[model samples]
Target: MIFKNRLVMFLKRQCCFCGAGFLFAAIAFTGVATAQAGSSQPDVRISLDQAEQMALAHNRTLRADLMLISESKANEITAGLRPNPVFDTDAQFIPFFSPSNLNSDYMDNSAQFDAGLSYKFELYGKRKARIQSARAATVVTSSIISNDERQLRYQVATQFINVLYAESKLRFAEQDLATFDKSLSISQKQYQAGSISHGNLLKLQLQRLLFQTDVTSAQVAVVQAKDNLRQLVGFDSVPQNYDVIGKLEAPQPKLGLMDMEADALKSRPDLQAARQLILQSQSQLHLAKADAHPDLGTTVDYTHLAGNNDLSAFATIGIPIFNRNQGNIAKASAQITQAQEQERAAEQLVLTQVRSAYARQQSALQVVDLYESGYLKEAQQSLSISQYAYLRGDTSLLNFLDAERSYRTVELNYRQALATAMLSEQRLEESIGMSVPSGKVH
Candidate 1:
């Protein structure tokens, strides 16, 4: 009995140890799993600032333009430096010698050795012109980058909002299908009980099919919109159900066409870049004119007599009697004219676009207000009454279906209005050289 008791006590201690280990492991695993899950699924909420950051980081075209701007800045650094100097030397063999073995005067023992550096100092504001041109180029490049960033931002906003619109449509389509499904079930039951005709049952079935088709189409649209957004953001994989983090609101730009045009001149990067190009061309023109004047190079010639200790230096200056660089100057002048014309054209085009976009924005805003005040509310009320009356057998099937269709149409139109208004607002923002709103979705 004593031996058996001792063994039972030992086994009990082992079981307790095992139980303690299992409890520790369970606790550890639960903590670890909770931590992992939390880290893996961070709430993917992005505000406008976040969107801008993502575009800066991930937008390929914008990034490329940014690199171009950097390159232009780099070139500007090299533009102000002078050209490197060159060293020249020459030698002639004398075949004549004073002794009988060689002639003392064969070829003229006239070899020249020049050891001097010549620099062409741009005397007439030429270098300054070049520097100004380069600075202008840099400005233009920076403006182009800004323009690209704005464009990408607009594209992303459109895709993001369109996704929301499609999702709304899909939700409504699903609801519509569910309603049809319930009605079909009731209709079938009624048909069996001789409460309705076969034609009515068939009609319900057809309505269900149509709703199903709409749902499918909406889903497809969602997929396509997601794909487009992914490409814009340079994402290879699709994101999970992204909710737009901003609410749609009417834009309140308080500027007219002339004001916008002036802002565009100040804000549009392409126009600035074109203006910079003109300056660069002007600089080149100056450079060509300077070239037309014979580039004066002064050289000091040093002569060391062979086997003698005398060293003599002589200075010489060069003048161009031919090839006076007229062609180059003319070409550069023509380029300047071309650049000026292009800048004018761009300015005009921007003005036209700003006016047109503002008009469209105004029209879209009016439509949104009209729908909100009159049409959308009426459609909703009609749909509600039709649904209730149909359920109570106080309305004909045709009337109910018509009302339902009208409600769907108005709902779709409302979503479209929201999209149009948002898109128009974006264009207007672009037109006026305004930055995107920093406001987040409500």
Candidate 2:
């Protein structure tokens, strides 16, 4: 910023000179402005929470699942509706071929006319059972959707951390390249002044290529990771050029392994969904049994023929000798047993996931601790000391090069350790069915 201001003042002074100088100043200022604008931060930057929320709102699959709930509610309405009444009307002895004989007196005296209404009423609480089954299925769907949301959250968080890791690696690569470039520059001057041999200078300059390659690889990794994260965040939810912004290292979780396992059992939606499935199956069995109970049909008729009027009533019921819905009842019973077993399996799965995630996070934490236990600082100090000694002719070039490589390796490893620890935290939270403690641990 200071350089930019100084350059602006210098350009203004030049503008006060010849018109040619003014034109040159204007061009220079335009170039500087373009560079500054290009280097500015991206317009779309999202944190982890923002990405997860956007995914939840805009993910097509999730929206489709929510639509199924509406469908289930509609099914409930259909189940609660009663059967429509059947209407019948007939005319005899004066059909279309003999329409001339169909006058009012003829229709009443000669022709016979009849009208009837019939309805089949549901028996044994069949309608109620149907409604209950629909409702229970809807409840199961809701829990399944909740579990899907939980999985989506974990997926988004994991990808967000991946992007963060890639960005951190890119930054570290650029810094490492710049630091090595400075060493190359010093080697160039030393070779010219005969302070260093030409062969040694060539080796230093050649090694700079490795640092440049690291920067290129890191850039590619960053782009790929961002693309993967964008798929989860929903492409339309964020701009194409969006960048992720968050801490590279996750904070230590406050909860222990046992606590995490207990929390998962209490909160994991998959377990809830599994338990709901059992109720859904039971409701379905009740509906199946209700289907076996045949409904009663009743009809009332009015007739007029030969100047006589008559009224009649009829009732009907199925014998239920065959096709008594035995298959559906048996299937529903089997489903109840399957659902019960699934619920038990879900519980065990939750415990296993919690334990595995907690173990991984703990291991990652220990790795991060090892890096922070002076190894990283010592590597940097060793490099700085060796570089100083080599430039002053107090040490050999091999010693300086080895120290530099050691420092680079250690620094990169430390960054990866931090990223691993943070990713472990994300996994642990996913398994635990809630967010653990976050932010800097120390």
Best-performing candidate as measured by lDDT? 2
Q: How many backbone clashes does candidate 1 have?
A: 7
Q: Largest TM-score belongs to which candidate?
A: 2
Residue pair clashes in candidate 1: 96-103, 96-104, 97-103, 97-104, 140-273, 245-441, 246-441
Give the residue spans of candidate 2 off by over 4 A. 1-39, 95-103, 437-442
Q: In candidate 1, what are the lDDT values of residues 1-442, reduced to their tens digit?
A: 7976676566566555656554554465456446545656434655555655676688777777778878887777787887666666554454345435344333223332334445554455656666766777777677777778777777777777776677678778878778778877877887888876555555665566567667667767766876677677667222554434665555554456566667877877667767777877887887778656543444444554443334344444445577778799899999999999999998888788788887897788788888889998899899889877876678888998999899888878877887788788778777766753433222
lDDT of 2 by residue, 202-248 (tens): 56755665676676667667768888888877789986667878867
lDDT assessment of candidate 1: 0.69
RMSD in Å for all candidates: 16.3, 10.0
TM-score of each: 0.75, 0.87
